[model samples]
Target chain A: MQKIELEISFFGAFRKYERTGPLRLTLAAGAGMAAVKAAIAEALDPAASDLLKVSALADAQQVLSSAHVFDTSAQLVLLPPVSGG
Target chain B: MSQSPDTRSIHVCVRETHLSLEKASAFVDAGENGAALLFVGRVRNHNLNKPVSGVSYDAFAPLAETVMGEICVEAQAQFGPDLRLYIEHFKGYLPIGGISVIIAVGSPHRAPAYEASRYLIEELKKRVPVWKKEHYLSGDSEWLDGTSLVENP
Candidate 1:
């Protein structure tokens, strides 16, 4: 099985719970978004574990649907609700 | 605000540069449209009794743009095809009175222009994937929940 690299990031209040800066994770190419999201939750400091249930996910160009598969390059981000006007 | 030749609407963006009303309005110019309504949002000097010094925003750019575009498209549809839309947001640091967001709508009448502009702004605030950290004059900073529309968990 081939592995795909996804550059992951946390935004807003999630930063305080982040273990480190932007992370690049390699996962099996066939992984589902749920699996990827689980991995992200596992990577965060324990205090941030709850955010996984609500945080939105997106790539560099668009929001990723929940059923997305890991078949392409991923600039993954965990987004909280936005407040821009 | 950017007036990309390919994207005249300039409907979505997240950047570090200051927002420009001129650029936003120009992007949505409808030559024969009777009204071009432009709304500029600025960081307020006070909030919750705290004197705010400035604000810094961060965004999940790709998703932010995508949602912003959708809001613009939806507003156009609601208002009418003749109406054009433009939306832009500035990230990084912006002091009190600094422009944070811009929404411009060009429409055939003042009613639709005003209506669409309000919808675009409210929807933008509710949906765009951008967050702001407020810096207080007391030298303390906190991330005020930007998503007032949703009860944050």
Candidate 2:
């Protein structure tokens, strides 16, 4: 078994956490989006979990689903509900 | 028969700069197109009775632009290929009355122009990867609620 480090960025209401830059998390290799979400929840306070539950994970190109598996370190982001007009 | 919008005829961007209605109108302008509709979204002085000084916009620029392009393409495909569109969303902080977003549509007729303009704005609100934080005069700020993009399991 091995572990990988990921830099997960935040957006929208989550920007308050961004002041510290992206949240760094370590996950087991071959992890998927669900595992990533769980790791994020574990890293932050419980209050953030509600928002995290609804937020979507994305790579540079598109929104990723829970089924998306990661085999290596990645730069990702958390996109909360969008409010742009 | 209508086809997808020509990539050249569609202009979409997400930038941390002022959004210009003039640019939007100019991009969608065409001699053959008789109708040009412009929808500008501005930062107002208040929201939900809270006096607002301004607003700060944050966006995932790459995906926001992509989503906007897709909306414009879809509008043209439904309205007609002759439809030309310009869509932009502003990022960064802005004082009250600053333009936040603009959607311009040029079409051969008013019907399609109106429809396309409405379609673009509505879809942009729902799909774009952008967020708004309102700054209140009371020294408080909050992010407004919005349509979610997350997929439910």
Candidate 3:
């Protein structure tokens, strides 16, 4: 089993949540984004999968669509769309 | 186009109507701006047919500041050397029509300043970790859901 290192940032209410971590999830070589998100949910906050919206980026610039597969190491940012003036 | 913090300028305070035009002007001067555009956000007294008595705001300060800084960096990167930007949001109680946030952008040309200022406010509202609670005269208090009030139990 190959391991992929994922760096995650939790913002807003997620930051105040107890189970948060700068999580690292290992998956098979051709793991998809969905699989990675599931792993993150299980590791960090299982309720995160329901309460928050997740977006993934590779190398900080490229936004990955939900159907996209994770090919290498990447940064995954979770955002819940908090309000500001 | 210097990245050094401007000691003379003051970031606008939360729940205040008056923006420090003086500091904003200084920021423009530091940016060597020929054109400056500022956007002020105000509180509304009503939401979805409900009367609003006032508002209370909450924020994750460290993260909010970092995100605001990132927004400034991105605006600069997109608009280049001719552009400078400032963004401030109010964090406490604000009455109807009170200024809640201010965003100012300066550029050599009018177009970039206007566009960047608008984009900054839009993106900040959508992405920042700030929440607002709305209190009504009828003893009802609810959190604002984006621009609307969400009913709470």
Candidate 4:
């Protein structure tokens, strides 16, 4: 497996941990969404883990499940549970 | 998601500007659909005994829009195909008493319009990729996560 660069976008309080914005992570090229998400959770401070795990990923169209496969796309979105009324 | 963005009889958006009730009502307004149900979400002054300064809304734009559009579609399907739906949410900082969200539905009858309007707001709260940060008067800002802060259970 080759290492590839992926950028993860965050919202809500997760933004505080990712102040640099769109955190850049290097992971196996063929990693699936769940794997990358695991890595992200492990990389973050404990306080941010639940904030990330309870979230979903997004590309340009819609929110993706953890089953999606990663590719060369540099940008990904982390959407935490919403509370809009 | 629909193949073409323009195909749906609904509107979805996530923006930094204030939401507009008139715009939402106009979009779905039709002569045949006399029932226009509008729900406006505004920022209140206090939460849990703390004076709320305001709120900042952040969203996964593409995903938020997609989910909102899908919600509108589902409401239409459940209510009636002729149901016209308009939904929007505001990003950026909204001061206390500011309008943050607008859900407008025009239907052939009042019952469907009322039911669909309620469904749109409830589902939007649960499913949309939007987050609200409450900036309290105590100089602390807190993320309103999930249904955790729902009052009265």
Question: Whose lDDT is greatest here?
Answer: 2
Give the alpha-carbon lDDT of every model: 0.77, 0.87, 0.63, 0.80
Across A29-57, the per-residue lDDT of candidate 4 in tens digits comes to 87897788888887788887756666776
Candidate 2: where are CA atoms >4 Å away? B1-5
What C-alpha lDDT does candidate 3 achieve relative to the native structure? 0.63
lDDT of 2 by residue, A1-85 (tens): 8888899998989888777789999888999888888998888778999888888888887888778888888998899988998
Residues B12-74 of candidate 2: C-alpha lDDT, one tens digit per residue = 998787787788888988899899999989999988888999999999998888788888889
Clashes in each model (backbone N, CA, C under 3 Å)?
0, 0, 1, 0
**DockQ of model 2, rounded to 2 decimals:** 0.75
Which candidate's DockQ is highest? 2
Instruction: Residues B69-116, candidate 1: write the lDDT tens digits.
Output: 877777766778677788888888998999999888888889999999
Candidates sorted by DockQ, descending order?
2, 1, 4, 3
The reply for model 1, stretches above 4 Å from the true place, is A16-21, A71-73, B1-6, B9-11, B147-153
For candidate 4, write residues B76-152 as lDDT tens digits.
77899899888889988999899999999899899999999999999999878788999988899999868421112
- The predicted structure with the larger DockQ, 1 or 4, is 1
Q: What would the per-residue lDDT of candidate 1 be over residues A1-85, giving only the tens digit for each residue?
A: 8888988888887777556678777889889877987888777777666556666777666666776788876777778766676
Taking all chains together, each candidate's TM-score versus the true structure is: 0.84, 0.93, 0.59, 0.89
Name the lDDT of candidate 2: 0.87
lDDT of 3 at A50: 49
Which lDDT value does model 1 have at B64?
77
Interface RMSD of 3: 7.8
Tens digits of lDDT, candidate 3, B1-153: 324333233232233345565666566555456787778788888888988888776765555665566666667677664576777787777888777787887788888888778778877886566777788978898655552111120
A29: Cα error in model 1, Å: 3.7
